[model samples]
Target chain A: MSWVNWILVICMYPFVLIMYFCLKNEGHDPKKRVYYGVSLSKEQAEDQIVTEIGNAYKKQMKRLLWISFLTSVPVLILPSFSIAFTYWCFWFLFVCFVFFWPFGIANKKLREVKLEKGWTTGEAQPRYTEIKEAAGIRKVKWYHFLGPVVISIACVVWAVLQPRDGREAMLIILAATFGGMTLMFAALAFWMDKEKTAIVSSDSNVNVNYARARKNMWKNFWVAFAWFNTLYTVGILFYQVQESEVTGMFWLLLGLYILFTVILLVWVIQKSKALEERYADKMDLKVEEGDDAHWLWGMLYCNPKDKHTMVNKRVGLGTTINLATPVGKGVAVFLILTLLSMPVLGIWLILDDFTPIQLKVEENCLVAKHVTEKYRVPFEDVREAQLLTKLPNIGRNYGTSMDNVKKGNYRLRDESISCEVLLNPENGLFIRLETEDEIYLFSGFDDTETRQVYEAMIK
Target chain B: MVIILQDGSEVPVFKQIRNQIVMGISDGRLQPGEKLPTVRALAEEIGINSMTVNKAYQLLKQEGYIMTDRRNGVRVRESFRMTPELPLESKEQLKQLVSEARVRGVSQEEFMALVEEYFSAGQRE
Candidate 1:
């Protein structure tokens, strides 16, 4: 297999690993029955029933694994789509079939087992009072915000120092976005830090330690994210300087980010588990299930009671919006619109390869048209129009190019003349038109059309 | 001070917040001139509507229980004086309480003691 194919295979590893872990750890899930009100001891027959349930779960999981493996073969072997589409398919299958289906099944089975064995009890005792009010904002040191402040300053400085270029401008925008996000995350961290139990527990020491550890983890995660963003911004700038396409480096960086995220998630889960284990003896295992029911898919919080647009996830992993609120709904709509626009963008990009560029010399003007853009040059404003046998080294101001076809506004590096460019690099007339205000660059994609358009324009 | 909103309560959320703050100040749980959280901060912390919290703050400020400054968002009024005029609703509530005490077959001395207990309860803290 080629190196590209190897990268593709490697990219599939995370999904495989996630599926393996999900299936492998199914048996180890805590069997703590949330029996409401009445506390019941394990009966002699309960063990047998539990064992039966466990065995059934394991069997079902194994069967699912085999089925999933068989089903994925076709999808895996299917001709290459976009990498994003492939990864999305893997994720969708894992979530919908492998994870969600089995999880729902097990949950249903567990409920059924509890009901059959007469283990279910009365209504849950209210424990909202004991759930503890989150303490007010804690005093945050100035240094906690230093990383975001520094990144913000650096982004501003970089943007100000860099010469005006579209690619450079995009880089600066990305950096600014990253810096803004970092600052928001930093602010969120400080806000979340204030969440403490109102009731002083007998295990205050352990609680303090746990809180500290979690806070430190959050701080480190944000700092790491900031550094990663900085490096990525720098990478893009470097790629632009090298005059190289960003696709390969972009994918590599994205892959690294995904890998890092999975590792971070695993680390957080482990740490949280350790904290829970240490405090299990001291703290009550059950409490008021505050707003847990409103959460859909264990991620999206849809609480109308929450006034804030953004909130920390219950798992202390990341932020989630209260989607019931107007602001959250707006964000959700914007995100959906962005996602929906991707296909149109992809189609446009693909069409650029096939779309024929046409330059029509009419009675009063010359009209240049491509799939992505069109430009009209008035005869009155056109100062000079020339057809060159060979094109100069020109950079794209804003347009599309694939292999031999280049059509857009371009800047001539040697002459420093802005022009309309419509050129097929292989075999086309390089038409450089200098209008009164600006230069119009055009290059035709077809060799015949190029010669015809050149001859027509010159005549 | 932490404000807990009862999900099942018949009272509206804004009223609950207002009542709680009033109770806090009367009982000295919230001291005179104590700085209260910003409306937004409190709203976020309690996971309640900011408008509800703002309404509560507005009520408190109007009643001379709290004061607001440009730099310091809101605070318990240092003057800490109750309005001279009591609302008719409060008067009616007091009348109802007295009538209830009389109907319950309690002596005037016992009723007075009960009233004294409640009034001093706020001063204990």
Candidate 2:
């Protein structure tokens, strides 16, 4: 047997074991039960049933994430292995990873908490009751894996049986596989959209409004698609340059892809901007006197404002907590780091270096250091606070950041002071109270304000 | 005006709706004859099952807090007033308990004496 077959067999072993474990652990596990509003001894049987269900969910998620990740590994390594092997593994991995990542993480987190706290604990109670009810069982749909498995098997067989020694056959097979996958994805997305509409009655005005928002979002998907295409076109250009054997046909396709991408991106941006402006105007019109409308557009855009506000009230807390902005800043930093690291490590193999970093704010201190990054700051020495504000400038030099700054359009407003006090533990920090205007800077952080605004957040 | 659902609360959705409407009435939020959203419309707006809203409306109607007419939709009951009275069954039960107390060598005067003593004790702090 060839090395390809050996590798395939090794990969298949884990897949079979994972599937079996998931299937065996399909129902609730008694060990993970939660006893609430009753004596443990009296509710032991019911608790057992609940625990079993929770454990099954945990196992199912573990299986899904592991299988998805394993599948993705080969696919991600495909481009590098393409010359040595007939199939592309990277694309397969990419699709599986994206499809399962969110569900996997949510399930894993739930399971971890359940195991740590045990079944009888209130905190370990299954929080996904609604989701489970909606999804029915915590098992993968047979149809989900059917298309990919068939394609994978067909590729393996074709690679082994095909008589051609040239790369053309391999290229054709890869293209065909990708094309088929794309068609399947499009069909799936269409079906999901249809299902959403079906679940909510069409006559309901709220449903109608939600549907309109969804439609608007669907239109916005083109923005993401355009960006992807633009990036893909750039990758193809790089490939053509590196491998100088490209024909006229490749150039034609590349040119078409770039044109379509640019046009769609411009259209998406213009439409999105128009929609946003209109939305803001509508919201402004709806505001009434004495209404406790604490939400602004930015808050609504980033988080589900209604849900968060209700959650805050339920916890007997005010909606004054602004953890969203800090979380958003960390996410922005992550994205920047990932984008920066792309060239150094080939995008496909970048996951090997993936590590999570946490930045925490304590009662008296704030820390903005990553787990992987070399820089570390412990709030103690951070004595200075500055606010860098910028204004938009139109006309002569529209595109340059330097020109915009040089035009004195950017000025630091020193009228009101705001500052953050950092603490040791880094989960809860303090802000010195100054004035209403100064507190506006901390509005995004959690509607709270300080006497001196930090320079780090000004931009 | 819209009432938002409290997802994290232990309070049932129907109870939340009922309480909000009651508060609205007491605070003059809903005028005497102002038509409220139909059960279906309210349910849709709140993103909850229509049955939940219907249940709240049914409770409100039974309590004389709101009145629903086929032609006019639902509205705050005109000339509604809250009255404090013990239920017939509860009053009967209380009488039985007092009779039992009398059987145990406790007279009406003695019971009154105990009540006064308990009240005075409660007020002392």
Candidate 3:
């Protein structure tokens, strides 16, 4: 497990590097960043303002790249799972220092440059017609949603038919993720339709260029997300955990997912950057208008009057919540709560593996209790009871189990019956009972205690 | 082909849509029998209500600027010809315009030249 953590860290460093580059490269587009769509006048262009700005940006990027590389080296020394708390704190602080602080500084520098060069425009004069036409085209067609819809439906059918108890939780989570993404994509498409493009270009060609670029970026994003979700669902559906490779394949799949997501994000960022560079000249022109006050801390949008809860980032390919609005605040709170709950859930899962399971005899019935699930059997329903020293080598056909804690339905090898099993594998003291309808199997983690219970049951 | 709606304008939204389409037609930007976007599509494109676009389409249909059918949807009329006789409303409007020009002390020649300039501007667009 520690090695797994270390491997993850090592693998993620490149992703962090790419993210750093993207942030450092922010505001490289003077059209969108400085003039806010109003291109610089010919005089402004020849003033060497653009050149000075470029030099300043390049210097900052170079310095930040070095710092990023140096800071990331600490991961090599941090062992997986050891000092987990400290490691996580360091990770959090490192991210903020590298990304957040640098972003703010760079944004401020760009603003200063804009002021110095008199590049900031008075009003945004975007070609509204071209923008409207582009927005109309950017909508997600009916067919774009087909993949996720079909996948979710198939997941439901698979869950009902297969009924793998242990994997049921995993399957349901996958289904919800895909289904939720479908809804999100639809919502985002509509939101984008109403987005006020802030570029102030009179050049219809430049407006079209920007619009088409945005459209392509969104299209690629949705397509990639849909494909990734479908592939993950398919993987989970057909995945069989072999006895020889306990948890190995599962971990492998998780690692692959992380790498795939990182690659997708990098590709999107690089593509967006390329498009900006390619269209920068065409979009650069006389300054007209912009909304410099809409952003807070160079990242968060703080528009009190804006009705939008989520908006596209000025410099990137993601949506940021406008923290100024009530709805946005609610969304922010929800996100924070979700983030905080993850570690708590992890702790709960870890504790579940250690909790003792209690099985006791009652006046007229038997009771079994684990941490969460409980079971009971009336004496009247018991047809036969037997204690065995050895049990068959059974696999968890469908249900959850740790090293010793096992519960739920299972298939016994070389047997036709699908028995209801609730047992800890450590006990090796098997309690088999035959009811009128079927057989039930139970085991205990402690062999001595389990044997005594079995004897008492027989008596 | 661009419809710019002024929020504080005296004209309503539907009228704006109707006027733009009519202007587009007269300027030859919209060819004879050219297909227009469906009412729903136009409404969504402009971020306006469907009823507004519907009103505009209905007006265009009534004025003979556009025609609609079950299969073809909305389109510019196949042939456009100026009416030989001006409607009473249009005549009244012309009279008011002439009276305003007279009051402004503009010569008939100057007024005719201004009209020619305005009409040619539309053609150029």
- Best-fitting candidate, scored by TM-score: 3
Model 2 C-alpha lDDT per residue in residues B22-103, reported as the tens digit of each score:
7566555456776777775555334357798899999999988899988997888887766777558659977997888988
Give lDDT tens digits, candidate 3, residues A211-301.
Answer: 6677667777766776686767676556643322255465467678778877888787778778767876676443323435566546777
Residues A101-190, model 1: lDDT tens digits:
554455455556656776554332221211112333344555867755686668757865776544455556666765666676566666
Residue A171, model 2: lDDT of 36
True lDDT of residue B95, candidate 1? 92
True contacts kept of each: 0.13, 0.00, 0.04
- In terms of lDDT, model 2 sits at 0.39
Q: Please list the residue runs of candidate 2 whose C-alpha ends up more than 4 Å from where it truly belongs after superposition.
A: A1-169, A176-259, A276-281, A285-341, A344-459, B6-14, B18-125
Across A189-308, the per-residue lDDT of candidate 2 in tens digits comes to 333332222112212233334335544454345334523433443344334223233333443553455455445544544554454344432331111111112222112112322222
Model 1, runs deviating above 4 Å: A1-133, A136-142, A160-172, A187-209, A241-270, A277-283, A287-292, A297-299, A306-321, A325-341, A379-391, A396-429, B1-6, B9-125
- Better-scoring candidate (lDDT), 2 or 3: 3
Compared with the true structure, all predictions reach lDDT values of 0.59, 0.39, 0.64
TM-score of each: 0.63, 0.27, 0.64
Candidate 1, residue A273: CA error in Å? 4.3
Candidate 3, A60: how far from true, in Å? 12
Indicate the residue-level lDDT of A401 in model 2. Answer: 16
Q: Specify the CAPRI tier of model 2.
A: incorrect
Better DockQ candidate (1, 2): 1
Which sequence of candidate numbers ranks them by DockQ, best first? Answer: 1, 3, 2
